[model samples]
Target: MNHDHHMKITLEAILPSHAARPVKCASCRTMLYTTQNDSGLCETCDEKHLNTLNFWTAAQKWEELVEMNRWFIRGDTTTAPYHIGRLWEETDPLIAQLLELHEYGFITIDSQPEMEHVSLSIAKKWHLIKQRAYLTCVLPTRHSLIPISKIDGLRTNLLARKDLLVTTYCDNTTYPTPKGQGLQDAIPLTPEYKHFTDVEKRIYTFRSTADKDKDVLTKWWEAKTRLELKQGRGKFTESRTFWANNTSRITKKGSILTGPDDGDFQAAAAMRPLVFHIAAREWDAGMEVVGMLVKMCKDMGFEKTFEKFEVELED
Candidate 1:
């Protein structure tokens, strides 16, 4: 794809009345009217709340849990970055319930937001990445001999293959791109060139990594040599130049471009692998969020569209 797209699908959940809007102080049940006191506690109770057994017990339990998980917990007193440890064993029952929900993947609790606003917002970005990867798989990389009579037939076949691949492997229901636009936009048609008198010609191009598959180059070179021997030297050179000019190379860590010296066969071999690598890396980055979504769906006893991503797990 020419451009990198980042699409996010947010999942939200409704909170209970008590958690959504607090009418009374959490500790003493006294009517609350202002935000002056933290933890939604009345002044009298707020001072005593910190020394309670429940508070200390919750803290100790959280500390032990982090230790078992081998994760560090730092104190975020006044200007420190917000961490889950900041809510260690809170005294208020409602806050504690919210914290538990955050821990279990039911909600995403950000330290900057009010406890009530910390609703679940799972981003379906990884799922989109996998869809992009599937689209890349159908890209036309291998060159096949085409007869003049079968040019239209080949185009029809290519279209059918793309449609089938996208419909089968992609979650099209929520895919941000319009139907028939995602992969089609990436695989552009090559400029027309006259090849032999009245002969039908088309080039299927894709991006690839350099130096990974030398055998592909060898095969193409062999085919080129045979074609040149039969049809004269310059007959096949034009097509080869077209392929080389359009083909991209994965030269560095995050770079992809059409090098000036790349040959047609070398470009063809490198295109698909390079595109696959880019898509796979993007998919892997979002797998953590995807896993959380899977867990949340299981916990809620509901099947999500993403749960159908079992097809992607296969090689």
Candidate 2:
């Protein structure tokens, strides 16, 4: 799997706090802040490539950790490139990535392997190959997908610990994820810690910001007109409709997301309103997409379609 190349991490450096400023996006004039990558993309535009950037950023650390541990040395050892070793128990972000690589078959094993452990050199080599790949295939679009060193660094810290979800939140900014006890959280449940005594002090924070658009769209969907039901702009964000791709809008028809080919998108842009049957997910590479009842009914509104399928216990 392309063992001849080295992984290069061209991710941008972290900008100091003093250098921070809120500037307009060069392309769209949306607010661009220093908290993001030093480049020009706006927060909304930049978030689109976060998954891609995060993957490569993790790869860089994997390379560093493997190198620092002296697991494999190029041209120094007569051993073959693929070095089989017992899988590490450490859940360090880099080591976790190594485990992920083994899960995905990048790290191979012998025929009579014990518990099917990882191949160290192969995993490290994969780290190299992916970094090289990012440079060629992904780095060219750096303006759109520039790396945010601050966030990357923070995530590495959180993921290093096998279990550290969140500590605190900025007042009401975080999403109100349901408690395991009840909907009102009267008996606040904690997924992190268990109660052995009368009191088990635990905190489960919903750090992610609630999607503001959902509130607006929900209001619009509740009492939309027949015309609005046929054609209304309840949601503007394409990111909500598809997982990792907005281009799938072209393939869907008669659904809340009509075909991109049938003048549906342009009509919404020029004179018509747009309505999307929204479904959102947080996932990365190698995850599967399962649609329970994605089938569309043209007579039904987006709100009804959503209520029919792909829901959590509370949704």
Candidate 3:
């Protein structure tokens, strides 16, 4: 409105520093020594409370360096993800790694949205480290809902459903044993128990039979085909379902159970490990079966796929 006053303001803006030198941080009011601030934090407070770039993982940094370098090699350096300051807003490790790469001068981040979008896409496809059974709660429970530290006993002689109740302090706890059948160790299901333990979602795939028996795979294939054919464009009913983390480590983790993960058989068979459906019921038959397999492997001799086998029961 006033041309002379406006000219003075414009001259001041061009001459003065953008940030004002404050004695203390605007947020925490902590003492500021070397840092010249305009309502900003000191280095310590910045890293503790606000800095997201400070939490980079070494492995992820190396990886993003590779990825961004690939883009750099294509003669395009200024992409959205590389320039996004938003990527360092939260303590996500993947974004932290990206920030590290940017700091290293490989990436020149220009925008926020591309970095956020790209980082999120990478996060979605990221895999979790799958856990096999250790203190696995068998009692008709999903594996993810069972907290790793909450299980009571060491990994030896674990039962899922039959009266084996560990003392867990669930909210508003009440345990009632059924009449005449006598399930003193029956676990009570609670809303707190269900939701409180759902920490991380892990994924698993196929597990092999104990002896690497092709028969099991054959049966799986044949039965799956038969059942699929029998279904005939209807909803499939899987009578027997088996799941394992992988085909290896049958010796380390227990032999893969051939039945359902949640086979509430009204007995000890109701819980984790899910080994009720084994054809050979006797424990001696277990050794005999393994021995025969070992003999076969030994007869086949060295230079085979397996170096050796040891029957170990570990978590």
Candidate 4:
């Protein structure tokens, strides 16, 4: 994912003037002649209302104010309006309010990652106002992947996994579905979709390599265990067998599956000692499972610790 950014302004152009120049107050239709940029406020409003410092600071205070409202019922509680208004509001009243806020220096507009037409319109209005108005825009920071190294106590079993991490979009909504089912299922395998939609499932492969040690295995198990605690493990299976056609048909002596009467199933079975194994079925679940692998590796002091860990975050 990509994010667009923009700055809001109302004036067509701003020309610098000496500090002694006079300007009309954004509110009350009062002439603010003879006032410098430092004291642009009229005497009447200064005593009754907050000036630039208070107004701007109040708007800034809304920065981390993610909650819009809250409700409780049936012994459960929830909040709403994680975000207010779409990128912009379409109605004239809404536009008027936004402009009013701008005039009073209550809010600063920006365009970035996204410049919604509604938001752009607000910026245009700001531009039309004071050319030298103090303005700043902050783009939201995006995290692309979760850092699994920071988590602890991961564990996993053939059918279950844990320690998986997921990224979130919009400040306050539950991820929509389980993560990491194959393309055939409703969920997506790509991390982008995984984070955006809040899909929870095991998508990455998890298994032990010869280089891993007991401590590494322990940590991996702990992480997996945590995942199981949070999200119950969902399971699925895949089966395969290998065998040679015929020894005569097997022109190559070294070909295990190519020997005479060597059925395909037996041949495939011969390739790996562990056969008919089941593991976590979803990407999110798989991550939990892999967390165990990573933890174990770290505990054992493996040189290439955390090499197998995978996490998904919003773009």
Candidate 5:
């Protein structure tokens, strides 16, 4: 859940001066020193370029200048002999470009909860940028966790069964309901009481005492729902329930299920809910789906509201 408030935009490229060449300032046309003209501009002209409000226009011009000065898309040499000065300063020009982009709905900016920022490598992966020299802008974000409380609707039905196997209900017909009669009512009086009725009943003894147990169960349900939304009914049920019955060692203590062996218990108990391990296994896949959605938004070149993001979960 860790994310940064500021989205960092980085402009990186092999400047025109990366190759051995005498480049001139594209703006001022000044005969610049080799080190001073690496960016195809002298310090004064570079400052002026950064001062401009239009990033797209400036970027196009910068690309042209780099091409004019023999900037290579890919380089043969591993190292450059001279230093290329910073392309744009963090002054008014950079701010103006960011503001323009924000105003035009090309990027979004909002306050986000404090958390560890995503690493540069991760950001590059998310953005699908492989080029060495490119512009990146970090837009501030307002991100919040999808509330796990919705899982409450599924809790009683899911946990009430005697079998430890996890099950997914796609329709209301197969879904369980709250035990309205009595705990003793769950025990059938006769082996012949197999008549079909309006309600489907399967029950087990449940002692709902541990808050931690409920938390893990909530996470488990959330993961299941996300999987269902991403992969649809068939794959979600098949994949998530792969090891559902491998719970021979699990014993119920209150509402929490503890593993039979100390090692298993330790692993499960390390987290609040014993089911967290199961959910975490699917985390990467779920995040991949999320990343795909983000890439889609970027490609569409629009800022979406939080509700729009929620709509993506609709099954």
Candidate 6:
């Protein structure tokens, strides 16, 4: 981690009502206005209003709350930057709360404005390290090919907590995977270059707006075609294919990014679609591409492949 990076985060300020528009003072009961500087409270109370701003700024009470929120979720001591924290000074209470929760670690935050749901960071450590876990897919080349007796040993001592199985087949060779199916318990998956070409790659990309799963199924159909040809079956011939075609479309135009303003709850909630994308692949080679995807997804907490199970292959 980079010691130079300081986690700077901000909390929103709760200002007096009509601060933006000038209103009557609570004490003087005079109608002070901003447009004319003629309504609301008198000049005497204006000094008090200035003092209020000064007090809030000095207390940094909001910052304290934001930091607390981050700790509650991430259990990390880091936070966003100073400028990001300052933005909340103009925001409302709900927005302020959300920013604090985001800074702590409820979910990943992107600061980019163009990307919807983006999160922001004040500072970050630049150190890098690597570790291994079970439920991870590895390629065949990396396979240790343990004995049957050691299955329990591998599961208990080596395997990660989540077992992910993803597959893709040609349109013709595709078949419905049985419910409750998962990666092989005895054979752990790994990443290998040789297996990449064997991918039952999807032919079309899934879109949330229209005909969602149809594209995925269409690619499945392409994969199945290869399997059918091997069995001497002909081209696609299904009047009942409509259901398979449209199953994966997303009805809502969901955000792909999040930030401190979204809070921990919403940030976590936003990740479901992203994780689904990786999970829904037609087939997984255990250690090949699927393994690569899993490694990325685990860090993302499952958003890598949750949505958009469709693809458009290049010629």
lDDT (CA) per prediction: 0.24, 0.22, 0.23, 0.21, 0.24, 0.25
The CA-based lDDT of model 4 is what? 0.21
Report the lDDT tens digits of candidate 5 across residue range 42-119: 555454334221121222222221221121111211111121232222222333333333222222111111111112
Residue 123 in model 6: lDDT: 44
Clashing pairs in 3: 81-115, 82-109, 83-109, 83-110, 138-271, 138-272, 160-271
What is every candidate's alpha-carbon RMSD to the true fold? Answer: 26.8, 26.9, 27.6, 27.5, 23.8, 22.9
Where is model 2 poorest over a 10-residue stretch in terms of lDDT? 130-139
Candidate 5 segments whose C-alpha is farther than 4 A from its true place: 1-41, 49-137, 140-315
Model 3 agreement with the true structure over 48-120: per-residue lDDT tens digits = 3221121111112222323333233232321111221123332232333333322222222211111111111
Please give each candidate's TM-score. 0.17, 0.17, 0.14, 0.16, 0.16, 0.16
The candidate 1 region of ten consecutive residues with least summed lDDT is: 166-175
**Candidate 4 per-residue lDDT over residues 212-240, each given as its tens digit:** 11111101111123344235241212221
Which of candidates 1 and 4 is the stronger one according to lDDT? Answer: 1
Query: Where is the poorest 10-residue window by lDDT in model 6?
Result: 133-142
For lDDT, the strongest prediction is 6
- For candidate 3, the per-residue lDDT at 286 reads 19
By summed lDDT, which 10 consecutive residues of candidate 5 come out lowest? 306-315
Extract clashing residue pairs from model 5.
7-138, 7-139, 8-138, 9-136, 9-137, 9-138, 10-136, 12-133, 12-134, 13-133
TM-score, cand. 5: 0.16
- For model 4, the stretches where C-alpha displacement exceeds 4 angstroms are 1-27, 30-38, 47-52, 55-137, 142-315
